[model samples]
Target: MLLAVVLASVVFSAHAQSVPKPKEFYFDEDKTTARPIVVVEGEGEAQVQALVRERDRGRRQLEATAQLAHIAFSDGRTDLGGQLYQQALAQTDAKGTLGRAVRWNYAWDLFRAGQVEPALTRWVEVASAYGSPSWAPPTLALALWRLDRKQEAVAWFGAAVRTEPAVWIDARNFASQLPDWKQEDRDTLAEVLGAWQANPPTWP
Candidate 1:
């Protein structure tokens, strides 16, 4: 009887150990992908980790890919920039915000490559994206101005000013980059610069 009681206890213990318990660890649900993510320790840590991951991944996603392409453009690697932009655009759908932004990036890439006409066309599309911030119009206008489309540039600038006066600050900064900016341009830029000096952006 003692041996039988010991055997029964042993079997019960083994059974309990074999069964799986319900998960107790808390994780955030990534609704977009339905993946479980452990909470990051802090925002700074998360951002740093994300940037590290981005570099390690070689910008596998559309947004990162576009950013990489922009960097390539800045470095004067026209062929590589175009290739990356095309790859990014191909991965995104028409309705995707990433797609629209990549399109704009590609356009800027073209402009940097000295393909001005195609860049203007791409800028027009960017200007039409739903819920695009008011800051975009002035930038687009500046691009048009660079192409010497004076009337259209002026109209777009007016739209930007009416929609978001803050964009004038951006226009001023862009103008400052020109090698041969005239006195008139400098005067206009100064006015915008003064405004920005008085009220700077809270966020970079």
Candidate 2:
């Protein structure tokens, strides 16, 4: 009788252990993908770990992928983030606004990861697709500068100041940090900044 009771208890414990726990999910307000809710944990690292599991399960695949990519980037896993971003891009519409935002984010991630060539390609695509996203000017300028395209970098800085005057200060600050930028490029940026300051836009 004692042996049977012990055996029964062991079996019950094993059965319980075999059953997966129900995961609690919540909506991720920042993402645009369908079924954006994911499993949550207490906070910070624990939450991120839960997200990693959710990402692997293919639940809300695109949103989970993008979220994981962001978390990876924040955690200093830029290579993983870039790879995940590429996967997310494959799931997103190339012509849509979400696609543009994802591409821009991926480009920035690549740049931060020291993958300049790939970053340059993505930045060029962003610049060509939409005139100038707020981040495009400085980011594209940096990419161009890294590629030894000084003239193009100057042109983009001028475009930033002329088209998106609100980001002129950002562009100026970034341009000032480029070690390879020529005097001509600096002068061009200065000229555009002067023009923008002299004739500030009335509307935001």
Candidate 3:
């Protein structure tokens, strides 16, 4: 019964996109996820510089720049963010895991800025790549939701959850950004969660 409820309730919204995992910095040894990074708001450029100066190389560095781009977009500096995202893509040829992650971030940024067409175009490129990370499908679902393709969004969510049951935690965390993700969404998502909570997918 709980399983059915979790599936039926699979609540998530497209707006609650994930933050790219920070590649250039680490939490202080004593800190847990409870502690937040507290750089002053609007100093995103400085943060980017700090991350760049940390000597990231190859895919690592590209991901760092992508993280910087994410910070910039979150700070309302879309032009600067776009430039960094482009630079990251250039650095990696946009074909590997980190590269795909960067593309995902770039697509989400573009979608948030209401540049839906370009965002969707970029999303296609990310989806086609080999070894795209776990983040890709949910990010795609979020984009589809924002574009008002609710049914497609739901299907993508199902795929994401099916492929990565651990991703339900992500879905729970990102619940705010999915389609129909109101209180009602929470109720529905509980169904999906209930179903998968005990039987997360494993490699065949």
Q: What's the lDDT for candidate 3?
A: 0.56
User: Which stretches of model 2 miss by more than 4 angstroms?
Assistant: 1-44, 53-60, 164-204
lDDT tens digits by residue: candidate 3, 1-204 = 998777655643334333222121121221111122222333546766666664264335655676777787878899999998888788765566566656766776787677865786787676555443344455555555656555555555555565544545454554653442345435544544444444543322
Residues 98-185 of candidate 1: C-alpha lDDT, one tens digit per residue: 5666776677568667776677666556444444444344445555566655444555455444444553446445454433334554
Better of 1 and 2 by TM-score: 2
Candidate 1 residue 33 C-alpha distance from true site, Å: 21
lDDT of 2: 0.57
lDDT of 3 at 8: 54
lDDT of 2 at 109: 62
Give lDDT: candidate 2, residue 121: 72
Lowest summed lDDT over 10 consecutive residues: which window, candidate 3?
25-34
How much is 14 displaced in model 3, in angstroms? 23
lDDT of 2 by residue, 83-138 (tens): 88889889877556667667766666666666766777765665455532444554
Looking at model 1, the pairs that clash are none
The alpha-carbon deviation from the true structure for residue 172 of candidate 1, after best TM-score superposition, in angstroms, is: 6.6
**Candidate 2 residue 66 C-alpha distance from true site, Å:** 1.5
| RMSD (Cα, Å) of model 3 | 12.7
